[model samples]
Target: MTSLTLTRGATDTRTARATGRRTAWVPTLVLILGALYCLVPIAWVVIAATKSRSELFSTFTFAPGSGLLDNLHDLSTYRDGIYWQWMANSAFYAGLGALLSATVSAAGGYALGRFAFRGREFVFKLMLAGVLVPGIVLAVPQYLLMSELDLADSYWSMLLPSILSPYGVYLMRVYASAAVPAELLEAARMDGAGEFRIFTRIAVPMMMPGLITVFLFQFVGIWNNFLLPYVMLADDTKFPLTLGLYTLLAQGASQPALYTLVIMGCLLAVLPLIGLFLVIQRFWSLDLLSGSIKS
Candidate 1:
């Protein structure tokens, strides 16, 4: 009887270990499948960019060609390198808008999160409603409003409106509430530190990770933004990389030679964001993404 009981216990432990291994594999399998789905397109683009104009449609799907550098050169020389200018413009708008948006979100959210002002909750909810305001619906009205102010088809047309992101404000507020402690504010108050000073000094540091989150979201949005700039800017010189590549592709429909250039340009356009993510991910507090990171 003793021998039989020991044998059963050993079998139970083996079953538990096997069950754990199976559970671990479920997520691993899902992740590998997801990765394959995403990477297939990216790999296709890389291989597509390498092909020559005739090879784009005629060659095997994954076959390589030797025209990558030549295509890049052709794109560079197109319209005296207007594409590069578009890239610089995109960098300026996205970088500046993201920085300012992060600043505004950090301040606005910290105020709403920390202060006990009347109507604070109401104001926050109202601002969050802006998130639901569809981008397409708002873009037309925003364009008209900018035109009324004589700001349409210019840098301000793109820069000013892009900076006020409702989602960034919401994110900052949530992070500020969770990451910042009330007692710290009270201590700052006891020191007779001005409200803004305390916020800028004590609160901002604690909220740095959240601010990075706001910055990245706004940056990527502005970088990828097409409709706002499309409606706002008519001049090719002022267009962002998205608009430029689109125009290239639009022309590609008529001129197959432009296809390689568009694909190469698309590849170039993605590099900055990819580099930014790779560099910043280590510093980013992904814990804040789910909200309420433990103090």
Candidate 2:
């Protein structure tokens, strides 16, 4: 009877393992389908950007064309290279705005996460509310407010509003609460360190992963944003890449030759973001892992 029971248990275990292996394929297949869905458009754009004006319509959708260099040259030469200026403006806005936003998020998050004050919850709730407010709802009011300050149609209008991000604050707060130890802060306080010093020296370094994530989020949002910049600036020269690309697409409707330029411009726009991810992934992963372990 004992020998028969032992054989039965081994058979049951083997059956369970087989079932688990089969179930795993379900999620793997779903993930693969999701990845293909997302990648399809990007793949289409890359292939479309390679075609000449004539070949763009003539060739099969996925077929490679021979005008990649020619398209790039045309885009570079378009409107006296104004596209380059738009690219510069995008880089400037995203770079500066995200840096400022990250700084503000770190400070605000640290305070909200660590310090207890009279209006702490109230302030945190208010910021949380700001996150619920849509950008479109505020666009007109923001424009009017900027106009009142005589800053409309200028870089200030764009930069000032982009600096304060409620979501960034929220993310930072959560990260700080987890990544930073209360014991460490208390010990620092006992050693005569000021709040600001404790934050800068201890909290910020430990919270680097969260901060970088916030910066990257802000950067991508600012860089890809069309509505805010469209409403804020009246001058074409100050347009970011998104706005510039829209303008290019509009012109391409009348002059089909500009289609190739628009496609090439889009390809160029995508490269920086891809490169940023590739370069930062190593640091981002290590820091995130270390932070998770510490927490």
Candidate 3:
């Protein structure tokens, strides 16, 4: 009787294992299909950029064309190499805006997380409301405000607005609350350390992973932002990559030659973001992403 019972249990376990493998294939297949759907467009753009003007319309969409160098040369020479200028502008705005935004977020979030003050929650909630507000709704008013300040059509107009990200603050707030220990702060306080020193020496390092995540997000937002910069800056020289590519596309409607340049410009534009992610991926811990880190 014991031998028979053991045999039946082993058979059941093997059957369950087989069933689990069969059931898992469906979700795996679905995920693969979703991934392809997203990546196909990017693949098309990369292939499309290689084609010359004549070949762009003439060749098969996926077929690689021979004018990669030629297209790059045309893009570089277009309007005295203005494309490079736009790339630089994007880097400046995203880099500086993200840095300042991250700093402000860290401070605000740390304060909200560590301190018990009057209306602290209210202040944090009010700032968080900014995240729910769409950028489009704020753009016109922001433009008007900047215009009134005589800062419209300038770099400051774009840079200043991007430096206060509510989401960044929220992320830092949550992260600081969890990642930083009250005991550590108390110890520092007992040792006669200033608030700023405690934050810089202890909080910042412990919160580095979260802060890097916030910085990457803010940087991407500022980099890809089009409508804000469009409404603010009138000069092409001040235009970021998004606006620059947009203007190029508008021109391409009349002059199809510019389409190749637009495609090439897009391919070039993504490289910086990819590089940024590769550099910062190490700092953004997988454990944090998995929701294992809690406040």
- List CA RMSD, all candidates: 3.1, 1.6, 2.7
101: Cα error in model 3, Å: 0.8
Q: Which stretches of candidate 2 lie over 4 Å from their true place?
A: 1-4, 289-295
Question: Candidate 2, residue 197: CA error in Å?
Answer: 1.5
Pick out the ten consecutive residues of candidate 3 with the lowest summed lDDT: 286-295
lDDT of each: 0.89, 0.92, 0.92
Ranking by TM-score: 2, 3, 1
Residue pairs clashing in model 1 are: none
What is candidate 2's lDDT per residue for 1-295, written digit by digit as tens? 9999999999999999999998999999999999999898888889999999999977667988889999988888888899999999999999999999999999999899988899999999999999999989999999999999999999999999999999999999999998899999999999999888999999999989898999999999999999999899979999999999999899878989988888888889998899878877888989978867867
Pick the winner on TM-score between candidates 2 and 3. Answer: 2
C-alpha root-mean-square deviation, candidate 1: 3.1
Determine which window of 10 residues in candidate 2 has minimal summed lDDT.
286-295
In model 1, where do residues sit more than 4 Å from their true spots?
A: 1-13, 285-295
Worst 10 residues of 1 by lDDT: 285-294
Candidate 1 lDDT tens digits, 41-68: 8888888888888888786678778888
Q: What's the TM-score of each model vs. the native?
A: 0.91, 0.95, 0.94
